[model samples]
Target chain A: MISRTFRRRVWLVLCALALGLAPFPVSAQQSVYIPITGAKKLRLALPDFKIGSADPAANSLAQTFDGVLWNDLYQSGLVEMVSKSFYPLQQPGTPTDLGGGALAAWSAAPTTAQRLVFGNVVVGNGALQVEGYLYDLTQPNKPFVLGKRYTDQPTPAAARVIAHEFADAIIAALGGGPGIAESKIVFISDRTGHKEVWMMDYDGANQQQLTHLDAICYSPRLSPDGSKVAFMELSSAGSRIRVLDLLTHRYARFPRLGGTNATPAWSPDGSKLAFSSSRTGDMEIYTINANGTGLRRLTYSPGVDIAPVWNPKTGAQIAFESDRTGLPQIYVMDADGTNQQRLTMSGYAVSPSWSPNGEALAFSWRRTGGGEGNGGAYDIYIWYLANRNYLQLTHNGERNDFPSWAPDGRHLVFAVGENESWQLFTILADGTSPAKLTTAGSNTMPNWSWH
Target chain B: MSHSRLRYLCTVMGAFAVMIALAGCRHKPAPAPPTPPPAPAPAPTITLNADPTSIQAGQSSTLTWSSQNATKVELNGASVDLNGSQSVSPTESTDYEAVAYGANGQTASASAHVTVTQPPPPPAPAPAPQPSIQDLWNQNIKDAYFDFDKSNIRPDAQEALQADAEFLKQHPDVDFIIEGHCDERGSAEYNMGLGDRRANAVKDYLVQLGVDGSRIRTISYGKEKPFCTEHTEACWQKNRVGHLVLATPAQ
Candidate 1:
């Protein structure tokens, strides 16, 4: 039990401490990826976007935009959302409304929001207008962190896109690398009675079938620029590598190297592809120009040398899976196939996906005896090239495989199998917050876009 | 014989009296030696016969044998009665032999030459229709299984490929496709690559065995269509194989 004056003094001291430690200068031009785990999560208020039009669809579209923006910011792991219950009866919808006592109300008392994201949506004559802003509330004079305008057709799709843009701006302003809001994930799904390639948003929305070949298709690797996707297709022509032009939505001509070609992976520059082909009576890694000419074999070993993934930072190095030592293990080599070195020493490791920074590799590994079907379970592991340290990203008994790194380098999307049903799941690189991305039919072999 | 003998007898009578006197002085001469017995018969004779004379694999044949004037009889180096019969099943063609020992230390042997031919396949049930090339292939060619994430032609796979090569060579006009499959493990893309390796391993082995390479084609169905659907090791093993199929015109 304390006196009212003593309690008031303690509260003042705590407020002073919070004000001293909370605010950091977040410039809009900084491009470095500040690790979310290291950066203090800022408290941000994301009030509902104000609807500025009488159009019947504007109400729902604004709601959709506001919801999507909030989710994106929350999922970025860079901010802690201030509950709506803490908001005052009147919330600012634009920079002009941040005048008077609005900033003081948001920065004080129960709201205590150090940052605020406010926007307004308008629909008129067939076009949608969105003006979004981010303000640093804790700073003197409440400086603007981000302010942008987006215009598109007044549709739900456009609303979601506009909201994603605003969230990306806020993320980039906070010292995170280019946000992954607009990124897409391509994977294989069997929902249509036949396995085919499918594409979905980074958050598992807008799932659309990309291929209707009605034959088994797998390993859809989107190009770095998101213009084309290279996949492995099995049909009457035998197993071959095919590319789908995402820009034109047509099948691009990829030369058929006879006798079983598979697992086409795009180089960082998207000018070439590396894949495994048996044309020489052995499965070896080969690279060909995007137009399918200038074919060159990069491996000549006797055993299988397959699943080649180019390092995203620099295309000079390639990592792949090889069973040359009698068991599948991850290996790295120069682009010319020289200086071949084994990265994994024991157990079965395959499906090597290089991290976006090229400093590490993520692969599916069964590290115990007896291989698959034995007691050992396949788990995702990240092998750091510089430190030679490995971090196990999953410990679940379910089969977690094909770990494709997200563009942010802080997350991975992999196929998780349980009870014979496979689904896609995204997990943080630090091995937290495993969120399932797909549920309809079995989905597998997910490849995250490189953008 | 009449005159000469009478004269010799008169002369001998005077000598005989002297000889008798000399014999009486010899004091009980040794008893006359007994006459020697006739020589024994020659070495023992043996006859061995296989009842059916020949048998296929998994079939049995009876070996009957008899020996005359022999102290001991043995069949195929194993001792047996002088006259006996036994059932023998030999996986390969063999010779059934019998050896006999005579009383006077002489040996004689005879071999029946069982000629264990592969038993004519269970008299092909009922109608006994002639088997087609497809049937022959289905009976002889076997799928080569792979270990988890392996593509090397195993020792057992080599044997299977040898038999497949023989069948392919016998039917030169028939072209075939090797469908490589994988278990429900690993990435589909990598498994595709693994399946490709497996199919290529089979084709390369067949080519090494003198099968024409141009007549062979390969495809990999990386865990897409599994031969066994269960999640057990045995089932996974069944799914991981290089299965040979008769190629259709479109393929």
Candidate 2:
């Protein structure tokens, strides 16, 4: 008996050591928490983009660029935007305009913005050119923090693109991590008389249809690099996960695994996909290589286990939805399907989407009402993995579901039921700024890109 | 056949002799002839023809019909316009009759023959596509429903499975797939698991009822594709079911 107890003690120590030696870097952990807990936000002045040409089209392009940039900064939640009314009469249009007088005016007046963002847009021979700059108003000599020049076709879309690029650059320069301004959101839309996959900008611009299969599609998850989308498609044959190559506008060769394969989650490195399949006569979680090889079955429960989402930061663990405990709940397991840990105990929780930093999960939960059969309204909640604490992101008693994280890790896009029509909305992780993103027919199942 | 023909010939000859005798009697008449009553109105006459009277199987033909002096007309026991055409697709050779009626109960009738020829079997296509099993599955199979998130067969679900089993037992050669489905109230992924359980519950019950387990397959649609897209309880109940379809080999 003594030897047995001693062996048990050793085993426990080994587990503790294994947990302690996890590969999570300190810098990665800090990057995720700093934006959430950091209270002192830098106030930044965003003057309108100056129109370089007298052409009316250039004037519109400048307006469009300035509006997109301003919105991106506001959505980042990393900066305080100074009101335009507080701006000095002499706003900077370029780096040369950042003179002592302009800097002193911005730093001293009621407009005391700690930083400044200024840009200009010019239209020429079928091309739109944009010059953007970010200035540290408090720095000695007021050095330019970020300056970028972009050229694209002379269109509002191109203007928005340049603005997004500049906004992302500014966010990164401020040590806010990679910004999601230029990221895309893929979802299922039934606007074209069929449930087909669609894509749009992170801020709901340039909405475009991606698949014309004329068949029902669901749960679109964009790849980490924004080059492909994997989603469940229900054709006459059966339900299968199809990968669409966004760059080529073609279906990349994915093997047709039979027997109801669906809800594919891409690995962080884009090398493999984890999905739930019934190829062996039972629904189980399986991981397959992106090239359609290396198929590995991960879960063995007779109960249902599905909807796997990889940890974007480490890719070492996966959070998925399972009903093995007689009620649907959120569960996490190692990437190879070991070390299964249940994250939700008493509520009906599912669709566990890992935050970009891999430190927390956002999911839909009906936390009350007898688990099932009762009219329990689902709300989106974030469960922090470190402290095992959660923060509810939605309070309205509507059926909000399919919570997916933005690349910022501070915002989530989810579907809400309104007047029997489903729409997608993006809300901050702290339960603020609920912005509606879709107005068309029943847009749902939004998956924000990792980038 | 010869005997009947001889009898028919004798009857026709007798009819001719009687007609001749009547004509002779008319010439020699006048014993007690009264003033002739007003002649009765002529009966209606109808001409019916099926255009392209012969066609390959699955092809359609037009039945063009017209009637004269008719107050009412009927084609194949259905009332029709006096002078109209109808499209008819007959799987086999059929004779369509049209009857017209006039005043004083007078009537006339005609028939059009539409011979439907079986199409020539193509040598290269090998086997024709048949939707019989699919149609039979749709007609005979009944979906089994479960309570919210519960996979155990309820009393109502048991009755449905029993009826399904009766049909399956009679068709031993047929194979089918049980698709487990869920309502939109649950998470798409977890409902997948629930759906799978529901499907397997159905499969297990069928197997217990002496069905060949190998002949049955199961799939989980989860909540991705809801049969009923409403937010009410009735619609959600309709969405949670184990639907049956003919199990063609997966492609």
Q: List candidate 1 stretches off by more than 4 Å.
A: A1-39, B1-130, B152-159
Best by lDDT: 1
- When summed lDDT is taken over every stretch of 10 residues in candidate 2 chain A, the lowest stretch is A27-36
DockQ of candidates 1 onward, in order?
0.28, 0.25
**Tens digit of per-residue lDDT, candidate 1, span B3-74:** 999999999899989998998978976889999999787779999988787777778889889899999998
Local accuracy of candidate 2 as per-residue lDDT tens digits, A91-133: 6778777665667788777898898888788888878999888
- Candidate 1 lDDT over A85-204, as tens digits, reads 999778677888878776788888799889888888899989999998888887847468788999999999999999888888898897667787888999999999998999999889
lDDT, model 2, position A329: 80
TM for every model, in the order presented, reads: 0.73, 0.72
